[model samples]
Target: MPSTQFSLNIRTQPSREPALPCHETSEQARELVRGTSLELYSDGALHGRTAMVAVEDPLRITVSGLEDIILSRTPGDDEHLIAGHLFSLGLIRTPADILGLAFPDNDPGHAVVRLRTTKPRRSLGPLPGGPRIDPEGIFRLRERFEQRQRLYRSTRATHAAALFKADGELLAYGEDVSRHCAFDKAVGLALENRLLAGVEIAMLTSRLASDLAAKAAMARIPVLCGFSAATSAGMELAERRGITLIGRIGRDSFTIYANGRRLDV
Candidate 1:
């Protein structure tokens, strides 16, 4: 796989101790480089009880106008973060739409993208209004989720995101400790390969919140499912954007938060 490189002049600050409820000693904040390494933790009894630690900076991606969103949890190429974000928002539809992404030689935070199509104007139709969700697609989405959670078994520390076609073909998958990173990576993969148009469903391992629902709505995905719960604000956004927000997914059931017609049986 080809890689894109960019550099950051990050300043490491002293780790401040977090406040504790009743405990006397707050765990000392550990200091380390922010983005260069993964912090691995142990899993069980005696050893797990110990503070097994490593140092690294939390990963973050800043869009030109959007505030800098932190991408901690899972780690990988940052470019994927941007690409995956675009895919979920429905901006890039086909392989030819996203030409390529380049981080200029000296600019670290800015990325210049070659679009497959002329950048369309931002005016979007009214929030996709309709029934809450179609039943069949919602059920199938719940089933596909089991296969996706296997990634969590490996890192226990990473969040996963997957993009699916309407019929449920898995198009792209990404994992990061940060839900934002996970989605970004997934979108990046689609844009890099021009596969967004083929995507109809997105499953994220994060809470279905306003920002997330907004992104999926912007990407034009019809439905989004999450392993975690959805906030009231997220439900509102999904309703307004015409995106179906499904959460509390299990092997047999799931909750449909908005735009049911898209999930119509």
Candidate 2:
């Protein structure tokens, strides 16, 4: 529980807003799995062995001294997760909106984000449409997404989210104990690096839920693809936001639940 801070100077037009200090800090542990021994009964014989299990911990996000959310996630990419989460929740429009981000010295699990604006900014309207993505491109993106899940391969207890260009160029990948955290981390990376300026799509290993679809919309991603099923609410949200939501993406087939205009067979 030590405190370390790094400052990033962001250039902006002269304004009355006071400049706030930004701190970048991270936890030391980045491994996704914890080693523990468990007793197993296999082939009618007692077998005691060591196992690697997925790690989960609480991450508290405080935004501009007003709204806060606590998430249970793996111990890496915490800053990205918080940034992405705030963006996904429509709390901030751009990365520059965040004036400062501080990780608590006494607690590695807590983060405080000071915003340039005093009040949360809500999404004004539906996201704009993007270029068409080939159906094959969606499958290719899913394949790449699966290949990037190092944590899941090790512990079989993680979910992943990957960002790709409309033409299927992979941009960033994030993995975590939960689908939401994984997606948030990926979006956060894109935001921090200004990688989302191009038309983009997001693919996930978990089921497509309404909230997840909403997050994609908030990020202004035009397409969302998942290897699993999609909820009815998810479809509704996607349609309203002009985001194409594709689910049940298999090797040979897939279903488009909303905004089919964005995808071409």
Candidate 3:
């Protein structure tokens, strides 16, 4: 992936506040990828180093006491992951449909979502009208999205997803070992905060795959931008779902694969 040149004013200052406490202790350790230390030889010199990698673990999701599916994630934001997963899969229309989310006391890797309704899942339909975004606004949103990727900056092994308004205000951001998980986390955060009622845009550090495009469509986001290319299936889905898919985001340029009318050049 191309390096992001975007910088935020907050980046210059050290964060004085301690990291937020996590409810699950095991989750913290799982975020750190472990591997044997290795020695590097360069320019006739040898140096030993330990590197931090992104972690991936399987999470089993169950709905109403029934096994649904399993996902590999980076361990944190399990609740958001479940919420986003359900929404993207078209299992629930809104957050109110979710009665409660729980993790097993003995197994943090297992999550169950209790729903108020047992409706059959459906595919995402066409989205409502969203605010028109210009090329400059897309660039700014991507820059802000990249700036919020703290974990990726540290490990360089994580993917990020950010929710932004068409006008370029960032709503929420998520980073995880898997691109899908990252997108789900961001969507989950927005849903919890009731921030997805309005038409929004989703920016990702990963490629615009069909799955991610479908997630954005299901979430009712009208625009999806990525730092990389979009798959053919993704473009087709975006076109059918009324989503404007923008990919290959450069510093000041981007390619619109679908719904270009929403993007003012």
Candidate 4:
């Protein structure tokens, strides 16, 4: 079975029992799954290494588009991920436009979303309309981003996904070898916990591109910010999908590639 199939139920030896802080001798332990570990050696001397593989829950999403064409993918939660991705991309304005959500039986990896209005779809283009952060906001984005690089600090992992509000409050962060998985896990967690709607920006540690753009589009995110360059496809999709793509973000500067009309300041 894939590691994602492992149940989250961690069993512990100690059953529920009251603990006394005043006790002279006492034992307290928390249940945890032992992740993979490695014993290293240098010149016959012992070295230490350990690793954890987070469980990934694959989900499917079904979207009912024009002409009765139903688009479905293992997008996890159809309503939440779609709403979340779309909100982040700026293609949607309110949740009321969503007609309803449908999860088809036996499709373990997907769900379908139905919309009330069929807005005219736009082709991908350069950054068009969305809120833009000033230098102070950009500075804060970099500072908070630097502090969240713990995965890199510990394991030298390359990809990370961070969630931020329009005001720039850091919400959640995760890292993975696969940029898709990293953002997927972030979006998955947010959907599982019903927090996707509140996110205003998804700050990615990877380049702004189409795949990421697709993920963000599925979630309806209004803005996607990256520290790397944007791909042609990514730029195109962002424009087509009405998502603001921010790329080449530096410590003291950044560039807006799509939907510049929406950036108020």
Whose TM-score is greatest here?
A: 2
Task: Report the CA-based lDDT of candidate 4 relative to the real structure.
Answer: 0.59
**In candidate 1, where is summed lDDT lowest over 10 consecutive residues?**
18-27
TM-score of 4: 0.54
Worst 10 residues of 2 by lDDT: 1-10
Q: What is the per-residue lDDT of model 1 for residues 1-265, given as tens digits with 9 covering 90 to 100?
A: 1122223211123224211111111122323112232344566433322221222245444334445544443333445665565555555554345445444543333445555554443626544433334456656765676577644553355677888876667888776666777777777676555575566888987899888777676666778889789999998877777787788887677787776666555
User: What ordering of candidates by lDDT runs from best to worst?
Assistant: 2, 3, 1, 4
Best by lDDT: 2
TM-score against truth, every candidate: 0.62, 0.86, 0.82, 0.54
Off by over 4 Å in 4: 1-132
Candidate 2 ranges with C-alpha deviation above 4 Å: 1-21, 24-27
Whole-model lDDT values for every prediction: 0.59, 0.78, 0.75, 0.59
Off by over 4 Å in 3: 1-36, 41-46
lDDT of 2 at 134: 80
Global Cα lDDT for candidate 3? 0.75
